[model samples]
Target: MAVYTVAQVKINDGERYEKYRERFGAVLQQYDGRLVAADDNPVVQEGQWSYEKIVILEFADLDAFNAFADSESYREIAAHRHAGADSLILVAKGR
Candidate 1:
């Protein structure tokens, strides 16, 4: 089964966040993951949306997603994102 990672983020520092963004793709590719969607301004059809950005990532399976997320390399790069923004990230199983 495929898995999806959904991230809602509010950036505090753009320059620092760029550092994280720049390295994200290469790291994701290592785990058979792909960026599905990334939006700075997403259309709100219903409830309140508090995030400044939204990102969706698709992976071959939960294990692949977990491997990418839990890797030491990713943890190191993720520090930049953590320092640059406030975010809510979640993983969901694809139907």
Candidate 2:
């Protein structure tokens, strides 16, 4: 089964966040990740969730997802993101 990582982020520093974005894209590519959704505009249609950005990344399976998420490249960029924004990440196994 495939796996997905869903992230909701609220960026505090746009300039710094851009650097994280660039680095994150490189990490994703290295792990053969496919971005299913990456958008900043989100309509609050049903929930109380107010997020600045929403991202969904799909991987071959749970193991692949782990390899990418736990990689040093991702951790380095993740630190930048932690300093630049508030991020909520969730990982799920696709049915």
| C-alpha TM-score for every candidate | 0.96, 0.94
lDDT of each residue in 1-95, candidate 2, tens digit only: 99988999999998778889987888999999999999898777886986789999999999898899899999999888888899899999999
Worst 10 contiguous positions by lDDT, candidate 2: 42-51
Kindly report which residue pairs in candidate 1 clash with one another. Answer: none
- What CA RMSD would you report for each candidate? 0.7, 1.0
Candidate 2 runs further than 4 Å off: none
Off by over 4 Å in 1: none
Best by TM-score: 1
Per-residue error for 48 in candidate 2, Å, reads 1.0
lDDT of 1 by residue, 38-75 (tens): 99998988999889899999999988888999999899
| Reference-based lDDT, each prediction | 0.93, 0.90
* Candidate 2 structure lDDT: 0.90
TM match of model 2 to true structure = 0.94
Please list all clashing residue pairs in model 2, or write none if there are none: none
